[model samples]
Target: MTPIVRDFRPDDAEAVAAVRRAALPFMVTTPEGIAFEVDQASPAARYRLLVAEEDGEVTGTARVGLAHQSPTPGQAFVNAYVHPGHRGRGAGSLIVTTAEAYLAGEGAAQVYSWVLDEPHFRTFAERRGYRPSRPAHFLRLDLSNGELPPLEEPPAGYELRAAADFADDPRPLFEAEAECTADEPSDIAAELDDYEDWLADTWSHPDLDRDLTMVAVADGKVVAFSAARTDGHTRYASGMTGTLRTHRGRGLARLVKNHSLHRARAAGCTEAFTGNDADNGPMLAVNKWFGYDICATEVRHVRELG
Candidate 1:
């Protein structure tokens, strides 16, 4: 059966999530999360979730969008995934072809995607003119059976709090996140200055478990945070973990993450996952100390739109 690509419909949420789970088991994917992403995307982003169907079954999916928050204009991205059982078909090729044309029409001059660091995946991207860039690793921890570090007390003048504590106002968390994100190592430079968008897209995300997210406050200010996303069952993933520049080297990142992991485990979460850029040694070391093992690696690939 020939596969055809089309824009994702609301009813395709579950199928899309299933495809993602089959292609990347380390990360958490939920139907509600998929719907939320499509519904909450900013207009500037031109976000489009594309699905490849064969005999009325969703066999592949791709997330196509412009880097709206990037300072550099004309930067775009498309990450495509084909179900393991459906590979070797033309679904991946068709999805990328459709996404590239759409992005080019949207005035994008460059596009980036993440290809799994496997010979077949690398060959597929290379055949399509995508050149390898930086690489990242997906790490997993067995929250149910692994030994997590004991929670430590925050330093003298610092205290730990739940993200839910800021229910009335989450601006402090946003401030810390913006600061940390701007410093993160990435192929695309993002400027996270829109608080309203952040509130809608992140703070209110369906998967964000405020109760499990731990924050480190110093001098009554949010200095570090470990954001947690859960599947409401057994899977928990670290959305982001960062410390303010002023608080670096103080072990605050570790402190908050440890607390969040313990909370997740107590809440019945059996597994935890996170990703880190290969260039980010500090974060990799931190995850290593927490007993996380590298489960998979993906290399970023980019191509000129001309």
Candidate 2:
């Protein structure tokens, strides 16, 4: 029987999480995270989580959604994954086709997906009309063995604090995220103007580890931050680490990220992972400085739909 594609059911959480981890080990995802991603997505995102089942066993998953944060309309994305053991069963194609039709029906003019750098994966995406766009690198650090840079004292007038410090009001962190995200390189530029959306999508995310997310505050303002997310187990991932434009000259990005790494190590995290746009030299340099090694590469693939 052909695989069945359908909206994610509550019980599909673990299966979806398993598929994602197997397909992209560098990223962190959990059952709770999967549920939260679909349940808390903003309406403008037009988000949908789909699972492909064969013989009553879940074999693939895909997340389809509009790039609601992008300033450009009709820009959307779909990321699909099939278990290595289930690859030739048509689960991957069915999920991607379903996701694209849904996205195009929702008014998306262009759809983007990330294809693994491996030749087979690239060929599969190309066959589906997804031309290469940009590449990204996934870096890994063995927190259990590799030596992490020792935590350092903040420079004068600069202080380090966990994101938890902003529990009463995360407006400062929100402002910092908005400023840094706008400057980050991307195929689809994003503008974060909605604080409520950020609060719902980011600040409250199930995987966000507020206590381990270090922030660099200068003159009582958030100048830089390293957002941390964990799988509630051994995997710790850097959601993002960025410095404000005005504070670029300083080493705040490195400072906060190193501090967060120390926190993660102390919290029993055995592995740390982060991704960088292949063109993001500064961040790549920072990860290198932290002894991270490149583990995998993924290329952004785009398909223009008329």
TM-score per candidate, chains pooled = 0.99, 0.99
Model 2, residue 279: displacement in angstroms? Answer: 0.6
What is the C-alpha local distance difference test score of candidate 2?
A: 0.94
Worst 10 residues of 2 by lDDT: 148-157
Root-mean-square deviation per candidate: 0.5, 0.7
lDDT of candidate 1 over 117-191, digit per residue (tens): 999999999999999999999999999899999989999999999999999999999999999999999999999
lDDT of each: 0.97, 0.94
Best by lDDT: 1
Kindly report which residue stretches of model 2 are placed more than 4 angstroms away from their true locations once superposed.
none
Give one digit per residue, the lDDT tens place, for model 2 in 96-171: 9999999889999999999999999999999999999999999999999999888789889999999999999999
Could you tell me the lDDT of residue 1 within candidate 2?
Answer: 73
